[model samples]
Target: MTEPAFLVLTALVDEPRHGYGVVREVEELSGGRVRLKIGTLYGVLDRLVADGLVELDREEIARGRLRRYYRLTEDGASALEAEAARLAANARSATERLAARSGRAKALGGLA
Candidate 1:
């Protein structure tokens, strides 16, 4: 999954959210690293809906505009879990290699 898709699924894990809500949650989840534009948010939402990973939970109108809320599907949760595990494994591999490199550097009088 792409980072935006992963984050969007993760954002919907707890509760259904409207477009703006998803955008805010994604930004917070990514520690401000992923600020999603309105158009991009809808694009991801549309793709997820088409993929059966997310569904339209409801629609409401507030302030004279329609607000569509989205929720994660079972498949989405599973996919997110798998993606998270893959990312964790990749991180661990990098950490281990970096530690080994640091050890070598130390042994070589900090040449690295």
Candidate 2:
């Protein structure tokens, strides 16, 4: 429901991924701004899984390591879209307010 959650969900939108994959994808998408710690990733994943947004979709053994893949459910996809729309709306409102303020300052003979 927040930035990290949204980022994680968005990363998972294209395909199912393990925890480390999700973390790496999010970091890359954010230009290395949102590097998630292991603990943080698991915590968020647990909450998402519990809420039925994400599920334990599959497990595979590769290179002798256990990799658990998570996939977003239909509800999860819908939720992510809703959150994205909400954030976009907020951003648009803020931009409008800033533009109005700038216009006021210019009208008052101040800097643009």
Candidate 3:
């Protein structure tokens, strides 16, 4: 999955969210790294909806505009979990390798 899709799914993992809510949540989750414009967000939403990864939960008229709320489907949740595990494992491997490299460097420093 793309980073945007993963972040979007994560934003809605805990609860349903409107477009603006999802945008804010994604920004927060990404530490402001991912700033999603409405058009981009809707694009991802449309794809996810078509893929059965997300569904519209409800809609409301707020401020004279229709506000749609969306939630993740079971498949979406499972996919997010799998992606998280994969990222975690990759991070662990990289960290271990870095630590080993740093240890060797430190040991070789005395010889140098």
- Between prediction 1 and prediction 2, the one with superior lDDT is 1
User: Which residue runs of candidate 2 sit more than 4 Å off their true CA positions?
Assistant: 110-112
lDDT of 1: 0.94
Which candidate order results from sorting by TM-score in descending order? 3, 1, 2
Candidate 2 per-residue lDDT over residues 49-92, each given as its tens digit:
88999999899998999999999999999999999899899999
Worst 10 residues of 2 by lDDT: 103-112
Clashing pairs in 1: none
Question: lDDT per residue, candidate 3, 22-95, as tens digits?
Answer: 99999999999999999999999999999999999999999999999999999999988999999999999999
List of clashing residue pairs for candidate 2: none
Model 3: ten consecutive residues of lowest lDDT: 75-84
- RMSD of each candidate relative to the true structure: 2.0, 2.1, 0.8
Error of 3 at 70 (Å): 0.2
lDDT of 2 at 32: 95
Global lDDT of each candidate: 0.94, 0.93, 0.96
**Backbone Cα, N, C clashes tallied per candidate:** 0, 0, 0
